[model samples]
Target chain A: MERGGVTVRVLGIDPGLTRCGIGVVEGIVGRPLTLVDVNVLRTSASVPIAQRLVTIERGIDAWLDEYSPDAVAVERVFARSDSSTIMGTAQASGIALVAAARRGLPVATYTPSEVKAAVSGSGRADKAQVGAMVTRILRLDAPPKPADAADALALAVTHVWRGGARARIDAAVAAGRTP
Target chain B: MERGGVTVRVLGIDPGLTRCGIGVVEGIVGRPLTLVDVNVLRTSASVPIAQRLVTIERGIDAWLDEYSPDAVAVERVFARSDSSTIMGTAQASGIALVAAARRGLPVATYTPSEVKAAVSGSGRADKAQVGAMVTRILRLDAPPKPADAADALALAVTHVWRGGARARIDAAVAAGRTP
Candidate 1:
């Protein structure tokens, strides 16, 4: 596929304590997005919280160094009834944000609904629907294994479709032009 | 007063996004504790979450480098009705943990009640009582400023009192002697 125009690469993170999904996608709006990479970083629950956080940080730092994405996207954490799970997710998300920010890369967070709406055209889309749409959009052989991995890819595609537009508007406003 | 026997240096962090409290205390169990340092690291709420986290990481790294404490202590975060506040705190605490872990320092988390009990003889002690006890324990003329700073000192004192005893037991067990 002959690509033209500016390609914005984004690294997306689905943050979790045990299994953090990471994916990178490259493309601009209205174009076929290319999958750069996808993987999940896991930390042992038996380890201390501090050690687990360190492992997550190292994994994120390595991804940032390898891909050198223009921007990083992370799933925004919400308070859930399960306090322990939510706390772990929030902590993992923090590591991702700090890793990207330290590299001076722009970082953005999308709520689950926002990501789903962007990828599947409906905020209320189920997991299977989102997975199916992601596979179709990226032209993948199959949906990324492990829901976390697919969710991460969906987040990247969402950023490319949404954040790219927002960035342009921001650039225009900065240039003293109405976006 | 001249200090005697293995003094353990501990840095305690009361993590918050807006104002993170950091304090260092050095002492052995059953001895006068010394306040080495105390301060609060503030990040503007108007800043992006990623930027705030980066600011916190830098502040923590600086403290770790300067104090070189034997261990790091952080306050355990609990879920509250105010989701936003708890989320920010969880994130900040994560940053503190990773900062210490990255330096290969041992990290421990003490609950609020544990800290209160360690300092004030009652698990339900109020903030004022904890502050008064900390001031008296460290033999300081006044309580640390900004409540957060005082709370941080309290956490360090709690860890020094508790962790020191636990360490001795662990060491003795490692030496094949019943603690």
Candidate 2:
């Protein structure tokens, strides 16, 4: 029986303008993932837009520097829904991706449903269900707060359980194509 | 009257994932503008997402280093329409904002209508009209190519004219609040 591969640390971002949720988890697939940290970075709407983005960027930079995650996962921005928040969400997603890329870490994005499915085994799972499952999976005292934080942790867990495998396959294919 | 205010150089970005348009112009509000440079940074959708962002980042960095614009103007992302490209647009916009923020330059965003109104005197002016007006304002031999470049120039021009006044007002308010 394989004891799985090396444990991978992941930082997940639930991107938003008002509150960007960030979470870090470490574990190998099929193993109990340890919750390293989870929190939301908040910025006021009154500030200039560029300054708001700077706040998010600073948060992301701090997390990346602290956790030193092996990979990053962010919620895929869906342009069809939530017209009001879509732009801010997408902007946050870009900041997350760039932070990971600058560190040479692999970056992946999953739709909201995929994160729900990975954590709760239902693509249509509600936020409460996903939060409950995340609590159960990490064996935490309580579910992460603010919903966005829970979503971030769920994304981290999801990427470890799913994106990790896909990343491995991608690497192998890239290596194969190399001369 | 006092020959307008100080000359302001603006780097305007028409953010797009496939082709980000960048332009630089220098002028004082209510004065004739001088065209500096206009070009598009191309990135293929086939490349990895992070890599694409890096390309845009690099282009912005180079432009900032070369031109040292007094401020940056990016077209505001509107999420209500164009679901197909909204995410990419927002992401590109984020990169632009971050680039300017890092350089300690003022970053401003203008809605599409505001840009049209400032450049062509009609809020609902079409792209061709904006482009023609941009050419006339800059006294160019021809309008910048690929429309996106022209739009970028128009944004720069708009920011110097309309946004400059707004920015001054904002600064005054900020100063007034500081006690």
Candidate 3:
């Protein structure tokens, strides 16, 4: 099998201000597998408020450097109450996109429902169910810790499952021309 | 002391698209002091663009809720070469400011040069020097990691040193109560 064509490594991340959960997985084409590493990363705010974002910036760089996955997958914000929250989330998300795109990697996004569905066979599965299914699907001894890690893995799973289907459909629609 | 004497805990954030450095400081009588705690946060494009921001939003909320910082100090973006980069930075900074202000916390801003001067003897001091000085002034264990963290600390230091001064001057001017 061709190197690039056969195997793909993916990084999945869950974004939050204080903590961002990250998971990395390897996928083989035509195989319902690919599970690798996972971790829960944190950022603190005890310093002056002005520097918190800078703290975040450094962390992302380290994450990228550490994993260097083939593709990046992240969850999309489903809903938020506060306008301020939505705005902040938007900014952080932009940085994530910038980082991935800069590396010339294919980046994909999955919604909460989509990730849950992929992992748990239910779009509205609760966090615990998703975590359990993640363990089952990946054949792990237990679900990843702190919940966020499991969520990140589910996002990676969703991307691996859906990304291929979308690519093929887009190719078919374009009749071999770039979209 | 009057209840409305205006004690603002301004969380100053320096926005870097990749790093998204943040600093949280409390402003009393418009004078801020850097709190001891600080660190790097990370996110990746493999997540949905919106999710990354959500992470940031949550981080800010946790800080605000925990410290009850009265206002936020944000470093304004000077023009950048790339339109997309500037646009994203502006968007992110805008979001950070809004998140604080929307919660009835006033927001303030400072420029990069201004932050440098406030932290270091010279506005053009190199990053290492700035980092060294930041550690010295704040009594930090080491220079904040990943240039962005240093930058974030710089933003906080600037806001504490200069943002407070600006706010007081602005308040006096607005009230026609100059000393």
Candidate 4:
């Protein structure tokens, strides 16, 4: 699951009840990243709610088993968005987190703005811009369709760049030093 | 997990990130419910968020394995409550749902008002009234501690009373008729 001497394999998840996207990437921070796989798992609305959650869990488990990434990256859900869609998103995120945690993988979360800024150099970058950047960074022939896949890849790239071992150690030290 | 000739074992969940409550009840409609078990599973905020989710998942799995309930009942999450607590609650609910779904058990969600009404005959009943009714219904010496346990038991009672086999059939028919 390694690319170079200092490579890190990352699995990023853009969680959604209807379409949960997963992307795996491998590379060091400064080097060009390789796209291992990209997929958008979907659960139909017609299924019972519990069964839908089961579908999401199975999809996530399959990805984790297949990729065995060094770290799992997830989109941080904000409670401020008081919408039904956000509730489903939060639930999907929880399922993904549990899957990664059960495997004892490090899990990091980044906000949407952080993901966009990391991928496109602008927090305010639109979807198309982020897609372009993801395609360029992964050296893909074209942007991943449906946007969710691209967002997942962006999340992986962001984690690999911003939340590596050195960054986590620094964060821990900063928290300790603050107290 | 059986009580009488007509036995219904229900595992009710009051989902929360920090203090998720689980109560198992065995009984029949129009009969005094038996309290099988009650517990609160806690995950502290100081721990890593992913680990917290893993703890929750493990707690739920343990309950399901031990209780072997016929059905799982959960408190439904509302998006209107724009608070951090609701976010964690939703996440925990998701984990519980997935655990039950993986076991092929039926999952039902009751709103707070519905639970109160089913337990106390009043939708606007306060926590004390609900707790008192829970004690009376189960013939307990005293109310379960921390309030969450009572709420979980109430949810299980509500599901047994309102969402039995007939109600589930009706729901399926309604869903099928919807289009």
Best candidate per TM-score, number? Answer: 2
TM-score preference between candidates 2 and 4, better one: 2
- Cα lDDT computed for each candidate against the true fold: 0.90, 0.90, 0.66, 0.88
- For model 4, name the residue pairs that clash: none
Q: How does model 2 fare in lDDT?
A: 0.90
How far residue B171's Cα lies from its native spot in candidate 4, in Å, is 6.7
- CAPRI-style grade of the A/B interface in model 4: medium
Residue A25 CA displacement from its true place in model 1, Å: 0.8
Fraction of native contacts in model 2? Answer: 0.78
| Each candidate: chain B TM-score | 0.90, 0.94, 0.79, 0.91
Name the better of 2 and 3 by DockQ: 2
Model 2 ranges with Cα > 4 A deviation:
A172-179, B1-3, B176-179
lDDT tens per residue, model 2, B105-170: 988899999999999999999989999999999999998998999999999999988777777787
TM-score of 2: 0.95
Q: What DockQ, on C-alphas, does every prediction get?
A: 0.79, 0.79, 0.09, 0.76
- Candidate closer to the true structure by TM-score (higher is better), 1 or 3: 1
Rank order (by TM-score, best first)? 2, 4, 1, 3
Candidate 1 ranges beyond 4 A from true positions: A1-4, A168-179, B1-4, B167-179
A83-136 per-residue lDDT for model 4 (tens digits): 868888888899888889889888888999999999999999999999999999
Candidate 4 stretches greater than 4 Å from native: A1-5, A165-167, A170-179, B1-5, B165-167, B174-179
Order of quality (lDDT): 2, 1, 4, 3
How well does candidate 3 match the true structure, expressed as C-alpha RMSD? Answer: 14.9
What TM-score does each prediction get for chain A alone?
Answer: 0.91, 0.94, 0.81, 0.90
